[model samples]
Target: MQPKKNSIIKTLKLSKKKILVFIFFVAALVASFLFVLKDIPESATIGANNYPQSTKIYDRNGKMLYTFYTTKNQTFVSLDKISENLKKATIAIEDRDFYKHGAIDLRGITRAFIYTVFKKQVQGGSTITQQLVKNSLLTPERTITRKIKEIILAFVVEGVYSKDKILEMYLNQVSYGGTAWGVEAASYVYFDKPVERLNLAESAFLAALPEAPSIYSPFGSRPELGKKRQLEVLRRMEEQKYITKDQRREAGEFQLKFSKIQNKISAPHFVFYVKALLVQKYGARAVEQGGLNVTTSLDLDLQNYAQASVAAEISTLERMNVTNGAALIAKPGTGEILAMVGSKDYFDEENDGNVNVVLAKRQPGSSIKPINYAVGLIKGFTAATPFVDEKTCFPNPGRAPYCPLNYDGKFHGVVQMRFALANSFNIPAVKMLKANGLEAMMATASAMGIKTFEDL
Candidate 1:
């Protein structure tokens, strides 16, 4: 009986030790978490001044070209001033349980973790508070440490600010698209009206842009994508019971007319190009709100002159169906862009006038003939080399033969390399390309600073 009692006592002692170790582990974890939380900023520190400053772009002669900013474009309207439809629409699409949930949604986080780990698909599980913290306080990094910081900051922000205040701050600071920031700015930029004037359909359309501003911008390259996103927003609104099915259908069917871009700036294309470079170097947030004063290599006078010339020339060529034109002038010695006219008229929305044709991909046409001839010259073919310019067809494996023809639809038989190149005969150029080898010609074109030919 004494031996059995001693065995039970020994078992009790082992259990006591295990309990102590578990308690110590939990305490250590709590202490480490507190330590991490101590470094995070309080929500009160984030204010109007914490918002990004406007970046000013200037020409080489100190002429102001454009002012880029979130704050500059933003109008600080109270929650009441903003449309109720926009608020509900944003909540429906962005976060349905925004008011009910805390700073973080446990279910959303769990779902995101499962999708990211087991399914190998990344998903955003951030609440509205988390998004505000990430945009305002945190850098745009995708590291675990950054995410942890974002979550912690979100909690801190929620603890200090009221839910309505947080929503107002978010609506006032979030980027809509292009140079527009916040709902008020977005309203003016997209609808050419005040925030209070936005209808339910317009509100839903605007709400769709915050997820991906550039991709869903109505004036952007894929304009049709914005409408698709708008429909999704309307559907979400209906599902959340924020709107009726009839309202959703009406909003989806509503035809929206986007405001035309009327930016008063010199050298629109060059300014945007330089802005892109700055964004690449300093990040989009910094370029838009860092108060950077960028002095570009563009000459304002030269840019104005070039723009006028291109517009005049395009107008005269309207009889021939040439409705748009672009011109880019650069200095010979330093490669400085003196002037860049992206289109005949930057405000012509019907003809896609805002597109920078100087940087757009296009067939070189006869302009590439010089490079072909140059390649031929390098590959033991001289200017006096004789080439038959008769009807010719290059063979293609498993495809129809590529037949070449001259611009005049008549062949000049037995022409020299110089005459064939000078006249821009298509048949001779094809023969030159075939003789020089496609690989050799492509390499030559790449070497001559034609980057688009490398992939071909």
Candidate 2:
């Protein structure tokens, strides 16, 4: 009986060993399948084409005066192009164990999953590589299948790219509010300079933007939340030994100088007109999304002078009941518009100040007289040819006779073509147009770059 009992126990132990061996074999098979998946080449390249960059608009002098981009206002920069302070701040705030972890942090994921499942709290455990993979290569739908793909792609990206390269890609691909993408564009948008010029405090502020760009944007309604996030980044940096406590405190107390809001767009209306032209030429999608570089004939110095002059003139004209003014200066030879002032102020929404008068069409008033007289001169009417600015009525089909009057409602009899156009005598200009014929005058105006005229 004792021998039989020992035999039974031995048999049960042998069965348990077989089950454990089978489990180990299945685990090895699953891992080998995952390894095969990782080995398969993916189509997405880690290159500059990952995001749509802004087509920088430069003045003739090569000064970047404006930028054009769609929703994802990305500007790609290498890791070395940014400051070390910014890099450290990003690592401190985003992934404390970045260098120490592999492609994924199993321990952190476990902890986070446990907290989420049981404690009703959520936490992130993804490494920097994971984030890069999720943002650049995968769709944003949160699902088990997508998560699995993210992990696989993260491992694959880690296998292909170095740690530093991955870190740089993450920095450049992340959004930082408004139209800003990447650290360089964000630095310029927030601080109006390159990332290399950022201080510890500014770097901390920027590092805080990636999590919630619009929410933490300094221009948003909750600016204090942005400051709070910035302070948290500084605290993390100090805790991680990237900065000393004193350095962190100093940075925290530093008065952050954010670049003035979106209004810094120089020559706003002119830039918009250029954008419209580009859209017409390249189609809206290509101009907005193709990352084109446009060099224009605009002269910034001239534009500044013109804007100043118009502003001064508007101040004086306001007393004369003129609430706004616009000016355009063009090179006579090339017809290149050198300067354009669209309105008295772009922000004065009450007066419709944002409306660009240079592009708007109204009755030319006496301005059309020059074209009429020029046509008359081209058709045997010399500058000395006589015309009378009298109260002569033009025939009307269904209404009272069409009579034109001068500014003073009095006519100067016997005016030459030059005098009629120079002093803008209304009846003489109308007679000149009639003599030259309306079609001939319209053709002459069209030849002189006046495109707004129509048959109506």
Backbone Cα, N, C clashes tallied per candidate: 0, 0
Each prediction's whole-model lDDT (CA)? 0.85, 0.84
Name the regions of candidate 2 deviating beyond 4 angstroms: 1-48, 55-70, 95-125, 139-147, 177-179, 211-252, 260-268, 298-325, 344-354, 380-404, 408-419
| Candidate 1 local lDDT, 323-373, one digit each (tens) | 999999999889899899999887799999899999898988988888888
Residue 235, candidate 2: C-alpha displacement in angstroms: 6.4
What lDDT tens digits, residue by residue, belong to model 2 across residues 151-202? 7778778887788988999998877877787888888888988798899999
> TM-scores for all candidates?
0.51, 0.73
In model 1, the runs with Cα more than 4 Å from the true position are: 1-20, 47-49, 53-72, 107-123, 261-456
Weakest 10 consecutive residues of candidate 1 by summed lDDT: 45-54
Model 1 quality (TM-score): 0.51
